[model samples]
Target chain A: MSLDIFKERGTPLDRQSFTWKDMVGEPYSKLDDDAFTRVRQILMHGVEQESCRFKHFAARFNPELRLPLARIRRVEHHQATMVNWLMPGDQSTLETTIGFEQVAIEVTAHVAAVEPDPYMAQIYRFGLLEDFDHLYRYAALMDRLCGKDANNILQSYTDVMPGRPTSVEHRAPEDDLRLHYQKTRAAPLTKIHAALITGSEWQTRDYYLTVGPTFADPIARQLYAEIASIEEQHVTQYEALSDPSETWLEKWLVQEATEVYAYWSCYSQEQNPRIKLIWERFLSYELEHLRLVRELMQKLENRDPAELLPAEFPDPLSFTSHRKFVRETLAAEVDLRARGYDIVPMDQDSPASIAYRAQLNAGGSPSEAVAAGYHWRPGTELTDRRVRDAAFAPLSGQEAAQ
Target chain B: MNKNDRPTDIGINRTGIALSPLDGPLTAEGASAAPPSSAGSWQDAAMVRLRYAAEASEFGHMPPPATLRGLAKTAKELLKGHKANVLLDKLGERLAFERTGVRLYDGLIVKFEANGSWEGGPTLEELVAFRSDEARHFELMVQALVKLGADPTAMTPSADITAVESLGVLQVISDPRTGLAHALHAQQIAELADVAGWDLLASLSETLGHTELAAECRRALAQENLHAAAVARWLKAHAEVAARGELEQAVAS
Candidate 1:
C-alpha cells in the first residue's frame, strides 16, 4: 500500500529522552539469522531516510530549522548505528567484511544496470570494478593472514576476481567530476540515486578513514588506506551528478518525500514482524518530517509540496544479484577512464593526467603495495585469466613502450 | 509553554523557542510581516505548530532518542559482553549464510537466463556475475570457518538457523509465479541484511581482538555498502518506470 506520508501522524519522543543504556537493545545472533534480514531492512530504512533528511537540511538557510533538524538527524543517526551494530558478539569481522563486498558487488551491478542516466550508470560501473578488485585483494589477505579462503566468507556467490586493478584506480581528483544532471530535467530517481550513492560511498570512505589506522598488520592497513582513497573518489563522482541549482527548500521537500518512499518500501516488503515494526514507526516519523517540510515550503516558497514529488511513490529499491550485467560491463568498460563529463579508454590521456602524475609523486601508494603483496600468489588471484588478461592488455602495451 | 520559557537542561536542548539568534521569527505575523530576506528564512509558524503536536503527544510509543554518543556507548557495552566461542559460532552461521547466498544467486541467474531479456530488468549476464560473487563468498566463509577450527559443513545451531533463514528467500525465488520485480525485492532485502550482518560481525571480531579478521571484514564492508546503494537505486528506478507506465496506461484509457 502507498504510504501517504503527508497524512500520517508519527510517534514523537522527547528530544534526548533516551540514554545509551536505553539505546542498547538486544542484538541478533545465529538463532536470529532470519531476523538479520529484518535488521538490515530497519537499518537501510534509517540510512536512506536520514540521507533524504540531510540533503534537505544541507540546503536550509533558516537557523530556526537547524536545531530541530539537528536533533532529528542525531536520532536518525543513532538509529542507523544501532541497526548496523545489531549483530551478535560472535560474528567475525572478516566474515562480515565478505558480506560487505557481496553487497557492493551485487548492489553496484544492479544499480548500474537500472541507472537511467548513461553517465551515472558509467560511474556506477567504474566504481563497481574497483570494489570488485578490493574483494579479490582482501580475499588474498584473508587467506594469507588467517588461513581462510575468500570463498568462505563470500559463499562463492561473487567471484573473488579483479575488476579494474587497484594499482591503477588512483586518478586525478578532477577526473572524479563528471557531467552534472540538470536538476530540473533529471528524473527524481536520478537525483535520489546520486544522493543515495553519495551517502554510501561517503560511509565507506569514512569507515576506512576511521578503521584503517587501527589494523596491526601494515599491509592490511595499507590496503584499506588505498581502497579508502578510491571511495573518496567515488563520493566525488556520485555527488557531482546532482544539479547545483536546487534550492535548500526544494531539496528539503524531496528529502522528506524520499524518506517516506523508502520507509514505505521497507515496511511493505519486510517479512519479519519485529523489523516491520521498526520500518512502520520510522515511516511514520518520516511522514511527519515530510509534512513539516511541506508546510514549511508552502509558507515560505508558495509552491505546492506535491509538485516537488511524483504523483505516486516510485518503486521500492531492492538488492538482488545481477551477475550477467556486471560481467558484461566488466568486459566492455573495464578499461574505460573518467574524462570530463564523459568516459574514455584507459590508453587515451585526459586533462586530469597531471593529477595522476601528482598522485604518483606522493610516494608509497597503498594500492601498489597491495598489488605487489599478491602478485606472487599462485591461485589466490580472484579474476579469471581471460578477463584479467583483457583488462591489463593496454597496460602491457604501455609497459612495452616504457 | 511560553515562547520565553526554556526547558531544563536535558541531554539536548528542546526548548520551543529558537536557540540561535539568527532564527527569524517564531510567530506567524512576525514572519509574514517581514519582507522575504534570504538570511531571515525560517520555518513557518504553522510548521512549528506541527512540531508541538508531535512533541506534546503521549499516546504512542516513539523510538528512543538515540544519539551518536549513546550508540557508541551501546557498542562498547556490546563488545564488553562478547565471548570468543560465541564469536566462532556466529562465524559458522555467517558461513552458512554465505552458502545460502551462493545458492540464491545461482537460482536467480537461472531464472534470468530462462526468462530471456526484459525491457529494463538486469541481463542474464549480470545475474551470472552476482551468482559468481556469492559462490566466492561461500568459499571465503568456509575457509574462515576452517581457520577458526570449526566445521563449516557440520550441522551447528547457527548453521541450521542460517539454512532456514535462507530457505525462505529461496522459496520466493523458486516459485514460478514470482516476477522479476518481486524476486529483486526479495534479493534487495537479503543484501541489506547481509551488509548489516557483516557490519556487526566485523565489529564483534574487532572487539575480540581479531585484528586480521576485523581488517578483512572492513574491506568487505566497504563493498557491501556499495551493493546496498546499487540495489536501492535500481529498485527506485524500476518502480519509477512502472509507475510511469501505469500513468500512461491510465491516460490512454
Candidate 2:
C-alpha cells in the first residue's frame, strides 16, 4: 500500500497508551486522586528504571556524575535549555548527582523498551544515546558550575568496598528482589529508602511547567519547554491509567503524604551526607510544588488550601510482595584473549550480553542489519572492505591507485 | 518544383522549408493508421479545457450579488474588505523579498484555480529558507501549550486569537502551480520536476524563508511517497524490468 494510504488509514498510536496526556490548559488541580497516583507511579517508574542503570554504571566505572563544588560558574544558554531555569543557586550540584542519575535510568529504560521497532528503534536508540550525551554534559557543567568532587561518591562506591557477587548464574526477577532485600535490607530499612525510587512522574509535568523556563538560559529554556511538552505527553499517559473524575484534593493529599514519608524514611538512614542533602532539597521542591498545586486547585475548584492538608504523614514506605529469582550460573575468571588480563567480570548464563550478542550474531550482512534497523558501527564497513579486497582483485582500488 | 507541385496538388500542405510528406502511405485506406495533428498537443489542450470545465462546475457560482453587498456594508469590520488583499500583498511581498522564495499567487489561471481557498482566505507565506525556524515554531507552540498545563494534542482553538488566527490563514495557503496544473500541463509538470520539482520548491520557498536541509529531506521523503503512485507509469514504460518486488528491493538496497 502507498505510505500515504497507510498513514491515512492507520490509527494514530494512542498517546495515552504511551503515557502521554492530552493538551488541556486547565491547571493540574483538575487531576483526581487516582490520576495523580498513576502519574506519580509512572514518573517514579521512569526514575526507578533510570536509577537502576545509574547503579550499574557506578558499579562498573567510577565516573563522576557531578562536577566538584570549587568549579562554581555561571550557567550557559544551552545548559539552561534542558535544565530547569527556575531552579536557583547550586542547581549544578542537583543536576550532576540527582539529575544525571535520573537521566541514566531513563536512558536505560528507553533502550530496553523502545529499541525494538524496526522503523523507530534507531531513532529511539539515538534518543537514549542523546540522553547519555546529555548526562555527561550536565555532569561536566556541574563540575564547572561548582567546585566539588562530583566523582567523590561514585569513586567511593567503586573503590572503597566493591560488593561481591552472590550469584553464579543470571538471576531472575524473584531472585534479584530477594537478593536486594538480603543484601541491602539490613544495610538500611526505611519506608522512604525503598520509596525514594518509587512513585509516579506527573509532578514533573507541573514542575517543569511552573519552573523550567523561568531560570533556564535561552537554549536551555527552549530545550526544557520542548522536553516539558514531551513530559505533558507523559502526564497524559499516566492519567489514562487512572480515573480523571476524582478530586484534586484527594490526589494531592495522597501523593504528598506518600512522597513526604518516603523522603523522610530514605533520609533517616542515608549514610552519605550528600544523599541526605539531596533528599532535603527534593523535599523542599516537592513542598513548593504541592503548595502551587493546592493554590491552583483552590482557584479552579473554589476550595480552601488548608482543607488540602493531609490527615497524617503517610508511612515512609509500603513493601511490595515483589520476588527475586536465583541465578543459574556462577561468575568465572574471564580470559582477556591475548591481552594478559587475569580476571574480569564474566558473563556466565546471564542475558548481560543479550543485545551485544544479538548484534554480533546478526553481523556479516548489512542488508540483514538494515532490516533489523541496526547501523554498522563506524569502521566496520572499512574492515569488511579490506577483507574483501584481499579476496577480490577486480573490485580492489589498489590497481586504480597504482 | 515538379515534386513539390505534384505533392501540393495531391493534397499535401507544407509551410516550412523543412516540411516533408510524412514518408508513409496517405490514402483513404491507410488513413486509419495515420496519426492526426490532434494526437498529442491537441489532446492535451482538450484535457485542459475539460478540467477547467469540471472545476467550474464543481465550485458552482460565487455567492449571490446580495450577499456580496451585505459583506460590503460591514466593510470596516472586515478591515474594509481590503484586509484580505492587504494581507495577501504583505505575504507576497515577504516572498518576493526573500533570497530564494516564490510568490504563490503570481501567474497562471491554474495557480489561482488550485489554491482558490487562498484567494478568499488570508494570504500567508512560509519561509522555507531555514528548517530550524520552521521546526522551532511547531516546537515552541507544542512546548508553550504543555507549559500552560494544556495538552498539546487537545489544542483546539475554542476561540481565535487574532494573531494566531492570522497565522492559521497563512498555514493553509499553498502554491498554485502544484495545486491545479497536475492535469492541465502534466508533461510540463514532469519536465519541471527536480528532486522536489518546481511546485514543492516554490511552496516551501514561499512558506519557509530558507531551503533548509530538512525541507529537502522532507521533500525527498515526499517523493518516496509519490513514487508508489507513479508505479504504473514506470512499469508500463520500462518493459525490461523484472517484477515489482525486484524493483522495490533494488531501490531499497
Choose the strongest candidate by TM-score: 1
Q: Estimated TM-score per prediction? A: 0.53, 0.21
Query: Per-prediction RMSD in angstroms?
Result: 25.6, 30.4
User: How much does each candidate deviate at the interface, measured as C-alpha RMSD after superposition?
Assistant: 28.7, 39.1
Q: On residues B26-93, what C-alpha lDDT tens digit does candidate 2 reach at each position?
A: 21112233222121211222233333454553212212111233233433233234333332232222
lDDT of 1 by residue, A124-215 (tens): 88889888777766765665455555443333245555567776777787777877788777777777666666666676676678777756
Task: Rate residue A103 of model 2 by lDDT.
Answer: 34
Among all windows of ten consecutive residues in candidate 1 chain B, which has the lowest summed lDDT? B1-10
Off by over 4 Å in 2: A1-222, A245-253, A272-402, B1-253
lDDT of model 2, residue A308: 34
Residue lDDT tens for model 2, A1-402: 001111112111121011112111111111111111212223333433323332343334423412210111111111112122222222233232333334323322323232223322222222222232232222322232232322221211111000111111112222112111221111121222222322223334445565554432332333345344434433332233222343433343334333444444444444335334544444443344345445555666777644434334433332111001000010112111100111123333335333333443341211111112111111221223432253433312432443
Let me know the DockQ for model 2.
0.01
Local distance difference test, per candidate? 0.59, 0.28
Report the poorest 10 consecutive residues by lDDT, candidate 2 chain A: A321-330
User: Considering every candidate listed, which one attains the maximal lDDT?
Assistant: 1
